[model samples]
Structures are given as structure tokens and as C-alpha cells.
Target: MMRFILSLVLLPTLAAAQTPAADQARAAADALEAASNMLDDADGARDRVRALTETIQAFESGLGAMRTGLRQAAINEAQLTKKLQSREEEVAALLGALQSMGGGASPVALLHPDGPMGTARAGMLLAELTPALNARADALRTDLENVQTLRALQTDAAKRLQEGLTEVQAARIALNQAMANRTDLPKRFTADPVRTGILIASTETLDGFASGLSEIVTDEIEPAPVNLDGQIGELRLPVQGLILRRAGEADAAGVKRPGVIMATRPGAIVISPTAATIRYAGPLLDFGNVVILEPQADTLFVLAGLDVVYGEAGQVIAGGTPVGLMGGSLAEKGDELSPLREGTGTERSETLYIEVRQANRPQDPVAWFRTDEDG
Candidate 1:
């Protein structure tokens, strides 16, 4: 009876113990899903940009065709003008010759030996020349009108092409921003728990079975040093804040993917996580303000995308040293009496990303985070 009572007492405690870890895992999963969704959005934006680009290209091609037509029309107009001038000169010369005859002979008499034949011949010639000249002039006028119509169409088309090109450029810029935001997502998580758990369980099962048979085992291991230059430990948080993201995750909120992220109120002092020499300090790709510390020979600790940064690359920084002041909406002052004003809520909610890499490959950052009990 006493043992049963003890079991009942322990059951609730055991259940409570499991809850936090499970909750943490669920939270991690949710974050990963968010990151995935952000990536999808980015991809959709990219597709839009691509489609717009294609449309712009097509319009440009059409514009080229319109230009060719304009050139051809110009040539046709010049040829028609020359032909009209020749026809006008011929008519003028014929009229002058008739005038030179000085009315001594009938114009019809000059065309034929007999009066009847001469009149008939003159009438026939005038009828043919008048109609031919009128028809040629009309043809030229129609061609000129057609050229004007085409010119107007080309002008309109050119304007439309310019607008399309402008839209394509805007879409491209948006796509680039979306791609940058998506990159932050993967950096927020360690290995996906579902996959990691399976691998770990499989390995453990294999190890257990092998141990029973006394089989020789070979472990393929990657070497990692815990400290850099015998002075700095592994990279850690320089300030107290929530880790908003880890390395290799996508950032749904940022204009670009962040290598790491920490959330603190804006205007909050940001510090170095360890005492180490800065390897790189400046603007990084997509990280507005960045600082990289070589905490160990094999590891590079990255603090980046800050609105403000105080340190330079190659400078030595001690752990807890003020590296910069956080900017954005989330920053706040400890007290109303304090002269320092906090950042706006939006800025205060901003995150700082942290990344650690060895040989340019990403490793899980959670392994380095100290457990709550240890702290």
C-alpha cells in the first residue's frame, strides 16, 4: 500500500518533468515551419520577378521590330517623294512645251496630222496622264498616312515597354529582399528534431547491438576545439536575451537571411559573448552591421545585422564588453528617471543573429548553449 502511494506521488512529478522539453521541441518545430513558409513566400516572389523579366524582354523585342518598321517607312517615304517630284517635273515640262508652241497650231494638231485624229489623240493622252498622276499622288498620301499611324502605335508601344521594364525592376528588387529574409529561417534551428532523433536512435541501437557481440568499432569523428588561443571559450551570448534564431536558419522577418539572431529591446547594450580577437568587423552580406570573433582557431563567432556596432575587425574584445547599442523599436530604459530613451517597440523587438562555423560548415549551436541548471 505504501509503494502504491509513492508511485502515485512520483507520477505527477515525472509527468511535469517531461513537459518543458516537449514544449521546447514543439516550439522549435513551429519555428521551423515558420521558416519554411517564409521560404515559400520568397520563392513565389522570385517567380513573379522572373515572369516580369520575361515580359519585359518580349516588349523589348517588339520595340526592336517597331524601330525597324519605322526605318523602313522612312525609306519608303523618301522614295515616294522622289517619284512624285519626277511626275511633277514631267507634267511641268509638257505644259512648257505646249506653251512654246505659241498657239500657232492647235495642241491637238501637234499630236496628230488630221484634226479629228489629233483631237482624239490629245484627249486620250490627257485622260491617261491625269488619272495616272492622281492615282500616284493618292497612293503616296495613303502611304504617308499609314506611316503616321505606325509611328503613333510605336510611340505607345515604347511607353508601355518602359512601364513594363520599370515594373520588372521593382519586382526584382522585391524578390531580392524576399530571398534575403528567407535565409534567416534555417539559421534559427538546430538540426530538425525529427531527423536528428531518428539518426541518434539508430546509432544508439546499432551501438548497443554491437556491444553485445564485442565487435570492433571505428568512430569517424570531426575534431572541434573548445577554446581559441587558450583564452576564449566557445562563443556564447554576450547579453541576456532570447535567441531568436540559430545559424543555418531562415529569417522570415529580415530583408535577408541572418547568420544568427538575438532579441533585445532597442537601445540595449550589446556585448561580446567571449573574450576573443575580432576576425571580421564590418558590414557583411545582408548583415547591416557585423562583427566576427575568432574565439578559437577552428570556430568563428559572428554577430551581425545590427543597427549599430561599436567594435572593429581584428580588435580584441573581452567577454561582456559592450559591442554596440541595439537599435529598433524594442529598446527600452530600465526606469523613467533614466535619461536614456528606449527604442520604439518595433526596434526593441528586433533580433540579433549569431553564427559559429568550422571550415565554413554549419554545426548545431544548441550543443554549445549551457543548460539552465548549469547557468
Candidate 2:
């Protein structure tokens, strides 16, 4: 009877002792901690906007990791809880049986009806079962510990999520302020707005507008001819995004152009890919907000479809300087967390049109920017 009752406790197979969910949770906590530290360091950085950008990215990555960890932890906890609940009666019976037998510590508890020989045989049998029973006990203990740890981690992760969201928002606000106050870039020449308006009014096509760009130059200070011999195919993209349409590739409407179309997230930063002079910055025809850059004499890089255009025409900006921001409404807090629940990446809702012209002829943009790697 004692053996039969005790065997009931081992009826439920214990889960693996390793706590993968706990490991994931710990890693997520570390990522969040690193993001917090990065945010603190951003205050003293040389490029405040860039620093804040990095900080926001870090916070976003950490929050994503935490969400994944919390989800896995929850699943593991639920599985363990269900398993334990199913064997609840067996566990209770085992405890009662052990208590009645004085936990197998009393010699009288092991005595058999057939006297010494039977008693010895029963003891041997129990010895064989002891190791298996102990192993199950250890695994059960680990499962219970994991459940508790996962519960605590989930609770703590919620607090961290809120903190991360708040910090990222602050960084974004700081970035905006920094961009608005910036005014230290050099200028090759200032553009004549009146002449630019006249040129736009006369031109009907992008080619025609670009060809007459020199007509709007009020300050005709010629830029030094830039030698791009060694940097032909190694240039970074002006914005962080995925290449949606390659140069000369037809779109849904079967419209093909010599430039690539990039899909970017809302409010994503657009930077100058190289040290360049801004030839034009404003709306032109149906291109929406445009910023045409002259990285070299007779070479123009036209960036169109921007929500906001930064820097006036003729300003000499350094590589990686903020140029503009992509158009779209910022996601709310609930929307930011949508990726966690939906298992999808942040949506790229804005598109930027890029055209590279050399010696007045359009060139394939993929030859100028690396597109094999992830944005």
C-alpha cells in the first residue's frame, strides 16, 4: 500500500530542468539595462541628435527582446501549471502516504508480513525506486522555481517597458530640438528663391528642372570638383530603409525610373550620405518636398518625397548630417507595442525617391549605395 501510494507522486512526467525561459528573461533584462545606460551617456555626446537616435534605437531593441522573453516565459509557466494541476491528486496522496509511513525512516514501516526475508526484499525494491523518485522531485522543484521566476520577470518587464517608452520619447523630443537649433554648416553659395520659382514655373519635367538648376544660383561660387574615384560603390544610403524598387524597375502602375525607391519608417532620419552641397531644398512639380545635393561638380543626387526638407540650398553639409525626416504620424505607445503582439516588424509607411545624375545623365542608384545588407 505504501509503495503503491508513493508511486502515484511519480505518475506525472516532470519537464526538463533547464530554464530556457528564465535565461531569455535575464538576457532581456540585460539589454534594457544597456539601453538605459546608453540614454544616460547621450547627454555628453558630441552629436546630440545622432546620440539620441542611437539611444532610441537601443531602447526599441531592448523593449522588443523583453516582449519576446515575457511571451515565452508566460507560455512555459502555463504549461508547467497545467501539468501540475493534472497530477494534483497524485501529489497529495504521495504526501499523505509518506507521512503515514513516517517518511520511510521508521524500520517498522518497511516490515513485511513474511518476516525478515520479505522485509529485506521490500527494502531492496524501495532502494531501486529511490533514485527515480528523487530525480522526479528535483525536476518538479525546478519547474516550480521557473514558474515563480518567470512570474516575477514578467512583472518586472512591464515596469521596464514603461520606462523604456518614456526615455525613448524624451530622446526623440531632444533630437527635434537639436535639429531645429542647428546652424553651423558651411555654405558654397546661397540660392535665389525668385529665380528658382521662375525656373520651376518654366520647367515641366524633372530633367528640364535639373538642367536649368544653374539659372537659380544667385551666389555663383563654384564648388571644388570632388573626386569619387575610390568611393564609387561604397557609399551609404541617405536614409535607413529597405530598397522597395530598384532603379529602372517598374512599379505597380508600370512606371519605371532611373532611381530607386526606399521604404522607411515614420519619422526616420534622413542623412547626407557624403559631404555635399545642397543645390535645392523645397517642393518641385509633383515630387513633394525635395532636396537636391551636389556632391561633385556636374553630379546631382535628387532626394524627393520627403515630409520635411532641411538646410537651405547651397549649404555645405558633412557626411551623416541630418537632411530631413520621412513623412508619417508617429506610432502611439499602444502601437509601438503592437509588434510584440502581432509578431511583425515596425511598418515602413513612407517612401523616398532617390535619383543619381552624373554629367546630366541618370545613373543606377544601386551602383552608388550598398543595398545587399539590411537597412
Candidate 2 at 259: error in angstroms? 3.3
lDDT of 1 by residue, 1-375 (tens): 434432332223322232222333234333334433443354455454334333333332332233333334344445645665666765455445434433466654555556778768876887777666555444544544444443343344334434433443343344444333332111111223343334334543322311221112123122232354433234445544556666556667543332445665444445666665554444544447666655555566666666656544334545654555455542122221111221122323656666666555545555554312110
Query: What RMSD, rounded to one decimal, does every model reach?
Result: 30.9, 5.7
Candidate 1, after superposition: displacement of residue 228 in Å?
Answer: 5.4
TM-score for each model: 0.32, 0.71
Q: What is the lDDT of residue 179 in candidate 2?
A: 73
- Computed on alpha carbons, the lDDT of every model, listed in order, comes to 0.44, 0.76
- Model 2 TM-score relative to the real fold: 0.71
lDDT of 2 by residue, 1-375 (tens): 556544544443333334776677678778878878888888898887677766766665566566667677778888989987887876675466455544546666567999999988988987787676556655566666666666776677767776776776677677778878777877788788888999999999888898899767866676676677789789988876779899889999999999999987676667788888999989999999999988888889999999877788889887777677788885665554343542444456789999999999999989998777444
Clashes of each: 45, 0
For model 2, which pairs clash?
none
Per-residue lDDT value at 115 in model 2: 97
